[model samples]
Target: MSAPKVLVVLTSHDKLGDTGKPTGWYLSEFAHPYDVLNSASVSLTVASPRGGLSPVDPSSIDAAKDDSISTNFINSPSTKPLFEQTLPLSDFVGNPSAIAPFAAIFFPGGHGPMFDLATDPQSQQLIREFWDAGKVVAAVCHGPAALVNVKLADGSHLLKGRKVTGFTNEEEDMVQLSKFMPFMLEDKLKEAVGPEGAFEKAPSAWGEKVVVDAEGRLITGQNPASATGVGKAILKAISS
Candidate 1:
């Protein structure tokens, strides 16, 4: 049998809410999870909305000071090319055959996700397909924003009846970008999940929080600090 394949989706978006500041995928959000998955013999395909070189949030890389794993992922020769050569989302969305090989998908977040992935129609479709195929769907930080708009065959929101978490309202407040994002991620998540799907949050903004709802094909993390937990959950689901 072939190695377990995973699709690691990244955000190509830059520019944080017209502030002209650069914002893109958080390095550790992708790096930590990727390292864990890689060690598990998972092969990852990196894809982004715009393709080509996906931008890394400068602040994210800088903040990963104590995290050598993330630092190594950014600077290591083996991982450098993967980060630079992201396939376009259209490549997968335009050709179903191209997306057929993956057993699971992961979305790693930075503020950029709030700008694009949250409403990308193609992303919504891909996510629905993966869910219906009984594959694992996981995200961290602002990543869950992408799931808020996904709908299933029965015409119900994907997040409905599921328990999940993402970058909370307080986190946004702490960063002072709550007003800048296109939509409040927490509010959108709550709206999508409905009463049946409880959208809960971590008590603290930077807490390590993750939730796995097998029936919903969902795994989510509260913030960047939760990325490793999200990765472990994805690996557990895949292994199980």
Candidate 2:
């Protein structure tokens, strides 16, 4: 059998909401997961909403210096090119054959996704197609924002009655970015999942947390720290 193929989606939005601050995909969130999965021999494809260069959150760059994997990912010749030009999400939408090669879809966050991916209609449809195909759907940090408005064919929210986790309200407040985000991730996820679905978090803010609703074909990570775990979880899910 061939290695599992995964589609890694990044945010194209670069400006923070009204803050005039530059923000894009978080380095650790993308790099750590990419390293984990790629090292495991999984075939990966990187894509975004705009089909071109995806920006990197400037703040994450300095922070990621402490993480060797993330640092190498940014400077390495082999991996840095992945973000230079990403396949647009539209390429897979309405084209079942286009999406057929991937076994899972992943979204890595840096507050950028909370803006574009959260509201992109093409993204919603692509996710629905993946879900409807029983493929693994995963996200980390604010990436879960993409799922807030996704609905199944039966007209019910995709997150309904599912247990998931993402950037928590507390973490947002701690980072002092709560005011800048269009909507709090934790609140929106809780609302999207409804009462039947559970929104969990780590014991402390910024702690690593990875939620795997394998039966639901869903996986999520709480923050950048959870990226590696999320990738590992995806590998396990697909291999199983």
Candidate 3:
């Protein structure tokens, strides 16, 4: 059988809201998951709302410096190019067949996604296509922001009544970047999923947490610490 193809979407936004600080996709969130899935022979296609070069959050680089996989993802010739020249998300919009070959879609997060992916109509439509096609949909950290605005063909929120998790409010507070964020990830996820939907979190800030709503074909990781787990979960879900 052919290997499963997964679409990995990154953020094109590089600036933190009003802080004048740089922010893009978190290094560990993308690197750990990429390493996990790539090692398992999964084919990954990287894309972004604006395409072209996808920026790496500067803070994540410093934070993930000690992580060998993250370090290698940056220095490795093969992986570096994936994010360096991402396909434009617009390529998949209005073309269901363009995304049909992929078995799953993943969104790796940073504050940048909170600004762009969260509200990008193209990103929302792409995600809806994946969901409507019965494909796996996954995200980590602030990546779930992308789903908050996604609606099904029936006009219901895609996340409605699905179990999910993302960067917690406590974690955001710990980072001291809560004020800069447009909305709290935890709250938005809870709201999107609605009353029946459960939004879970780790025991403590930054703890690893991964949630797989199998029925929904959705997987989510709470923080960067959960990135590898999310990837493993996606691999399992797709392979099954």
Candidate 4:
């Protein structure tokens, strides 16, 4: 069989919070998974809601260049080509019939996701399509915030009965930026989704926590640190 095709979605936000300060994609969010998936020969595509030149966090890139995975992803001739090209969001708009091109959809997280993905109607629709298609739908950190508004055609939550985890409230609090965040993601998820609906998480910073609700083909990671774990989980789902 052909290599599994995976679509990696990212945030194109060029600014952080209300302060309008500059910001970019978190490194580990993309680098870690990009390497793991690339080595597996998965056909990968990177797209952002706003598209065009997904920004790499300055710190992440600096730190990654020294790390094994990051250095490999950057120096490898094959993966390096993606760093130069990215698909535009306009290509995904209202193309439900075209959604079948991918075997799975993965979203990497960073504060930037809170800026655009948290409420984009198109991104929500795309996610619904993935879930409906019975393909893997995975997100990490703030990437799960994008699920807050995704609903299937039947009006049920896309994640209604699925056990999933994301950046926890304690993690946010630890970052010392919880108060300034646009919304408490963990709280809103519990309130809207419910007690039995969500999964458990460990108390750790950038810990490797990933939840895969066997019934729904939905997977989630707790933070940037869970990127590789999340990628491995998605690979399992795709192969299954």
Candidate 5:
């Protein structure tokens, strides 16, 4: 059995709220998953909407305040290379054939994704290609917002009836970023799919809640805390 090919996508935006403070991808979001997949020697590639050394939230590196995985990844030499060598968005503007070689795709998030990823038609198209090929598509935090407008070949919403998880409206309020976020991700899902929609979230923001909807190969995480869990689930689905 060969190691799996994994593509890890990060965000390039660098501001949250009106503070004008730099905020890019959450370190935990990339660190946790990278550690998990790295353990198995998975071939990983980091890409972004604009790419070129995607910014990482400086706060995520605070040793005393981060999860173990986050701390470990920042301490690892191999994983750290991703932060230094991310591929540019223009590299895959037209659904490049290179993406199809990967076994799975993951979108890591921070407030940055809320600015660009959620509405990128090109990125969504890349996601659609991976899905249509029956590959795993995993996202954590606001990364799931990228699926908001994705449509299948049949013209149905990709997440229409999928029991997935992502950054919840409640958690957004907990972080006090609800207003700064382009749109309420949870509310948008509910509004798009209605009461019977399969969207679900964890009971607590810190609790890991990763859902793998039976309908499609969609996997989601509620927030930064759930990134590892979401990554594990993605690997499990692929290795199964």
Candidate 6:
């Protein structure tokens, strides 16, 4: 078999909910996973809702400039082209035959996905197709926002009966943007999964927590710290 490939979807929205301040995918949220997945010999295609130039959430890096992954993702020449030339979401639309070839699709979190991916029809269908095809679907932090609106073939929300985790309401409040977000990530996830679906959380804010469905196809990470963990989980899923 050919080497497995994973599609890493980033958010194109640049504003943090009407705050008029800029926001986008958190650098480490993508970088950590990129680093891990790359180390495992997995190829990746980076894409965004509108494509080209996935914005950097400045706050995510401003404080973590010294972090190894954050530093490399922001300044390393090796990574420059990937972020600058992101493909448009259209590249993956209307082609299940094409989408089916991917072993998995991942959404890296930031405030931005809550604005775009949650409602983007292409994103929703791409996820549904990947899930229906029995391929893996993964997301991290606010990235799980992408799955909140995805409905399975049975017309039930994909998250309706699955266990998952993401940025918690407590974490949002800790960031003091609880009111700034369009909606609480935790609350919305709980509602999407319905009463039977479970939303587990990390013991502490910014802790690393990843949730992979029993079958190993549906994966989620709790926050930025969970990136690498999620990446490893994806590898294990596809490797099986």
- Candidate 6 residue spans exceeding 4 A from truth: none
Q: What is the lDDT of residue 126 in candidate 6?
A: 86
Report the C-alpha lDDT of model 3 over 1-240, residue by residue, as the tens digit.
Answer: 899999999999999999899999999999988888899999999999999999999999999889999999988998888999999998998898899889999999999999999999999999999988899999999999999999989999988999999999999999899999999999999999899999999888889999999663899999999999998999999888
Over 207-235, each residue of candidate 1 has an lDDT whose tens digit, in order, gives 89999896536899999889999989888
User: In candidate 1, which residue ranges exceed 4 Å CA deviation?
Assistant: none
Alpha-carbon deviation at 157 in model 6, angstroms: 0.7
Residue 14 of model 2: what lDDT? 97
| Per-residue C-alpha lDDT of model 5 across residues 116-202, encoded as one tens digit per residue | 788877778878888888888888888887778788779988787667777888888987878777798887776555555677877
Clashing residue pair totals per candidate (backbone < 3 A): 2, 0, 0, 0, 0, 0
Candidate 4: pairs in clash: none
lDDT of each: 0.88, 0.92, 0.93, 0.77, 0.77, 0.89
**Total clashes, candidate 5?**
0
TM-score of each candidate structure, all chains considered together: 0.96, 0.98, 0.98, 0.90, 0.90, 0.96
Q: What is the C-alpha RMSD of each candidate to the true structure, in Å?
A: 1.3, 0.9, 0.9, 2.1, 2.1, 1.2
Which candidate tops lDDT? 3
* lDDT at residue 229 of model 1 (Cα atoms): 93
- TM-score of decoy 1: 0.96
Q: Across residues 129-176, which tens digit of lDDT does each residue of candidate 4 receive? A: 777778889988888888888888999877676677888888889978
Better of 2 and 6 by TM-score: 2
